[model samples]
Target: MVTTGHWIDSSWKLQKRVLSFVHIPPPRRGVEISDAIFKCLKEWGIENKIFTISVDNASNNDVAIRLLKDTFSMSKNLVCAGKLFHVRCCAHILNLMVQDGLSQIVDITDNIRESIEFVNRSDGRLLLFADIFKKVFPRFRDREPHYDCCPSEEDWVKVVKVCNILETFWATTQIISGSDYPTSNLFLQEIKRVKLVLDNGVNDEDDFIRAMVRKMKTKFDKHWGECNLLMAVAAILDPRQKMKAVEFYFPQLFPSNEAQENISKVTTVLFEFYDEYVAANDHDH
Candidate 1:
């Protein structure tokens, strides 16, 4: 689905970014979506001006990136026209952490599903849970906390914060218990286990919940130089005035830790090298 997304400029200002959004039709072909994007970009002359194209490393996205690079060569007017295209998203990294944490056990996924199903099946229980939830989380009184069976948002809600997750599960437990459900305790225990995995498997923390968070933050911090796109988007969502630099570097952030660090170091070296080269060139003149 082609949904609208924005970008920020150097001033940490929100501005419209994406010109064209394309979606691949079912029974996807590698060439179709790319051709469409390239054709649109070419016609719009964005390809000529674009210095980089950020995309995922999924097979199709990789193909699209390669095709885009080959079809649109460097333009004299565009800086770093042939430079590497970064594939990244901070939310995607958080998604990986959550997935990794959950993957350590098979039953957790099933239990999560079961917990949601149990509440959703009966209108009485659902309403009761909603009522109990209101007492636990009055902030959500505006809308019912319908547990998403499958989270399919553009940026899947980053549930990296263990405390927030535990609070959510605890609230649901309250609702489930209020409904007199036998599986409430089981659901609670499973949620605890999820937290444990995130703590131990994900990282070492005195408090499992806090440890997972620290680890995730450390991981995110390691790529801050490049993964600024995520912070920019986050800042935009919060309408924060800071993180302007992050917006500036948004296009260069990638998900891989080693890759991001290497790119960041190279970027630093290149900037210094360019400054020296410019000074020497001026002296020669």
Candidate 2:
């Protein structure tokens, strides 16, 4: 079990290091995981400094988070009262949603993959490759009697739509999971960008795409149904975005009924955190 740490140092630069990579004995349930995390935090003497914990979607992780929240609640000084303590890993959630969507088109993908492998497997096949894949595809369809697996033009259309839908997800994952840059400040817009694509996808006239997107949206909502306020708070923190980013994107990110409510929640959380910061600063003074 690896507990990694990421923070901005006094120099205002991104700093990351592996805090602990300890072995967890069998029966790694919520209690065990929480115990491990808590021990690691205390060993580093930064348990109280923790703002949030990110983990992939799992029942045990959920339980572990709740356990940790209860433990941390003992600290009266917790910022925003530990409301932001549990962060569902964005990359992990995206992988789940994307996997759900891709599974819908397994046959389509398999056909395409097999076809590509057929053509790229050897120098002889490479010699026959046309400058454009599409141009070569038809001749391939006609020449190879055994290539019954070639995707139809209709299947290719769905592939195009799938690629378009995943473009934002790919970009967001890249942006948020970067090793060389600070990602928190960039999370707000990247997340909204993904919502935009999914929203557009569900409306796609093509049944294949609409069905796939609906599945993905269900997973998206399951994990992020309630707006992760931290994303919005991050928006407010970014000088380039601030509250306006939430104001502008909320309407599109959520259902019409939930958008304003979510926006309100974000502002409320932001002010609550600010109040805590002010109180803490004054106490320090």
lDDT of each: 0.46, 0.84
Model 1 has how many clashing residue pairs?
1
RMSD of candidates 1 onward, in order: 14.2, 2.7
- Residues 161-204, candidate 2: write the lDDT tens digits: 88988888888898888867867667767777777788888888
Give, for candidate 1, the lowest lDDT window spanning 10 residues: 179-188
Task: Compose the digit string of candidate 1's lDDT tens values, residues 31-146.
Answer: 77678776776766556555455453356766776776666653343233444344343234445455443443324346446556757788976776677763322322224465
What candidate 1 gets wrong by more than 4 Å, as runs, is 1-13, 21-23, 26-29, 74-78, 123-269, 272-285
Error of 2 at 61 (Å): 0.9
